[model samples]
Target: MARFLGRRLLVAIPVLFGVVVLVFLILRLIPGDPAQIVLMGTNASPERVAQVRHQMGLDQSWFSQFVIYVGGLLRGDLGYSYISHGTVAAQIGSRLPSTIDLAAAALAVALIVGVPTGIIGGFWPGSIGDKLATGFSVLGLAVPYFWLAQLLILLFAVDLRWLPALGVGGPTALILPALSLGLGFAAIITRILRSALIDVYQQPYIIVARSKGLSNWHVLTRHALRNATSSVTTIIGLQIGNLLAGAVATEVIFGRPGIGNYLVSQIQLKDIPSIQGIVLFIALCYIVINILVDVSHGMLDPRVRKAWAS
Candidate 1:
């Protein structure tokens, strides 16, 4: 287990390094001058722009800047943002909790809604439950997030007056965003889990268990659920990566003050330091979630645990 974890960590190092380099270079390549943005007008004198560029280390060669950036990263210095006038670490810290909370709530809603629907759909294939599940899953996939968010607002917030339209602090603020994010994942989870459950229900062991006088529900819960969970766990793990990637769009539409909104602001302002920091932080989040999922799988399945032991 230790060796496997070590290997994952080792691989993550190069992966994160490459992400940093790529984002840094790409942001630099974008046709905009940070110094000029600071100058606030195109007619700013060249000498004044050069001084701002030098101060921000934009005057350095790409290689030199890259090396310095890497060194700063190794020392836990994520550099200052040219636009925000604040350290990247501070900026990320301020907004991290909102995004984390939003993602967690959304994922929770997905699992709560998806898991049972999938189990019922798989266990009772061709029945009314299966048809309903299929319909909901199809709608989930077909509906766009922004559209859903807007429709939810119009229905619940505007006409019905049950929830707030914008901003997030209370339960009302979270519901729309969470549902918007969860619906997509719920559809995906339902599909994967239904397939896994179907396969598990057909296994010889499940048939034997049923023949041995166990009720269908008992057999499904005790045997099929455990077997199906392994696949569900993998999907849930991958979904964490998706959340980090998709948070931006969801947050923007919802007007939630999260890392996604911060990222959007940074990108618009071309704040390279903040952009790089956020990207690196996101990569770390993905790696950590994947590792946790692997560890969880090891704990849940003895075969996996034994494989790690060997």
Candidate 2:
């Protein structure tokens, strides 16, 4: 396991380096100068604009700026925001918790709902309950998150008066946004787990367990669930990435103070450092999640473990 983890980390280095280059270039490729955008409403002179550019290190060549950024990143300094005049690290640090909390909550909802529905569907592949679960999954996937969010808000917040429309008030405040963000993930997980579990149920060991007088629930839960988790784990890691990306829209719609909202606001203000820092941080998270997934796959599947051992 140690060697496998070490190898994964080693392989991730180049990917992360590529991400650093790609994110920096992509942000610069977008039209509009950060300095100009930052000074948009100001009556600043050319010198003032020049000063802002200089302070932002924008006057430097792209390669030079890249070098500076890479150096700063190595030193754990994500640079200062051109617009906010605050350290980029500080800005992201403030917003990171909100995004993490929201993502975690959404993932929790997905697991809570997805796993059981999947188990039942696998247990009874063509029954009314299975059909209903499949139908719900289809609905969850087909609907746009923003549209779904508004519908949920309308139903629960406006009409029913069951929950607040926005803000981080408490657990109630979490329902609307979490549902909007998590439903699709829940659907995906359910479908995948249903299929995987069905395959596992048809295996020889499952038959043996049943022949040995094991009840349906025990056979499914103890033996089948353990084997089915590999696929589910993969889906979970992927959904985490989706959740991060989707949270941007969900945060805005629900008026939450998260990394996604912070990124959106900074982009409009052309806070390049903040944008770059946050994006890089997100990319890092994605890479780390995938790595963890790879590690988990190895742990759960002996074939993968043996391959890694080789």
Cα RMSD of all models vs. native, in order, equals 2.1, 1.6
lDDT of every model, 2 decimals:
0.84, 0.87
TM-scores for every candidate against the unseen true structure: 0.92, 0.94
Cα deviation of 3, candidate 2, in Å: 2.3
* Colliding residue pairs in candidate 2: none
> Candidate 2 lDDT, tens digit per residue, 172-289?
8988899888888888888998899889989999999999999988987789988898999987887788899999999999989999999999888767778888889888999999
Tens digits of lDDT, candidate 1, 165-186: 7778687798988888888889
> Which regions in candidate 1 have their CA more than 4 angstroms from the true location?
32-34, 37-48
CA shift of 138, model 2, Å? 1.1
Error of 1 at 165 (Å): 1.2
Backbone clashes, each candidate: 0, 0
